[model samples]
Target: MTDSWLPTLLTETSEEGYALAVRLSRTAVKLTQPSAEVRERVRADYAEDFGALIAISHVVATNFHTVAAANGFWRS
Candidate 1:
């Protein structure tokens, strides 16, 4: 895993930024909303973040592959 992506996640500072940063944040909130209800919310948040990260990573990796393929520098 690349450590470089760490800062990109940590640097987000807005509502949109929080949406991105929460994917990588170490913070967790304890719910006042009751166990069953809060459990669903937490699970959904995790699912959403995981999907977003996977999609973003896929796009980035695909772009890198395309660039490398075009350059022919990765041919071996």
Candidate 2:
């Protein structure tokens, strides 16, 4: 991932915010693992693990919290 990724976290809608959160989560994993082959090797382990799924959900939620705050909680 050589693209420049700077999160403004200033989304206009809650749906967009959620999508950003998911992207944030995926990006983190990509950066940490860095190797597609390694990530694919362990994919099944996390894919079938309930705890791992919940952990990822928590990460996305945490990222969303920041995104929401930056957007003023999407207030009108």
Candidate 3:
């Protein structure tokens, strides 16, 4: 076994990523409310941001799986 920081880093990154996802989702909901101004530019920006959040979530999930497999946390 080699001493590598990847596992620790991945754990921290996943935690922060989850926090970011939650915050982003809250902001998206607030922005999309009927009372909020839904201009074309704003709508486009929100869509882009939401897409980025989804990407981040995917990366975090992938990292978690990698870490689990590497640490022998999964059973056959």
Candidate 4:
């Protein structure tokens, strides 16, 4: 099952969420290996970046809103 936040963000046309999803999905696909051992090692490398992505998404969303507001898009 997907997280509740995912649909809400997606429906709101959240570019940050979409960008994060794309990055994570690409990482996941790149890590696919025939050996479970190699897969675990790959996941270990990606786990840290995964955490960073969460933080970065929040920053990106905040910036997005700020830019939108500056353009008077939020006044509507």
Instruction: Report the C-alpha lDDT of model 2 over 1-76, residue by residue, as the tens digit.
Output: 5556863778889999989989998999999999999999999989989999999989999999988888889985
Q: Model 3, residue 24: what's the lDDT? A: 48
lDDT of 3 at 13: 49
lDDT of 4 at 55: 63
Question: What does candidate 1's lDDT look like per residue over 1-76, in tens digits?
Answer: 6665334322222443434434433222223344676666666665768787787566555544444444353343
Clashing pairs in 3: none
Error of 1 at 16 (Å): 28
Per-candidate TM equals 0.34, 0.89, 0.36, 0.34
Counted clashes in each candidate structure: 0, 0, 0, 0
Question: Per-residue alpha-carbon lDDT of model 3 for 1-76, expressed as tens digits?
Answer: 8984233422234455454445544555566674555554466665669787687577556655655554454333
* Model 4 per-residue lDDT tens digits across residues 1-76: 8664223322233455445455545444455555777767767675779776786566556655554554455345
Scored by lDDT, model 2 comes in at: 0.89
Q: Which stretches of candidate 2 lie over 4 Å from their true place?
A: 1-3
lDDT of each: 0.46, 0.89, 0.53, 0.53
For candidate 4, the C-alpha RMSD (Å) to the true structure equals 8.9
- Indicate the residue-level lDDT of 19 in model 3: 49
Worst 10 residues of 2 by lDDT: 1-10
Top candidate by lDDT? 2
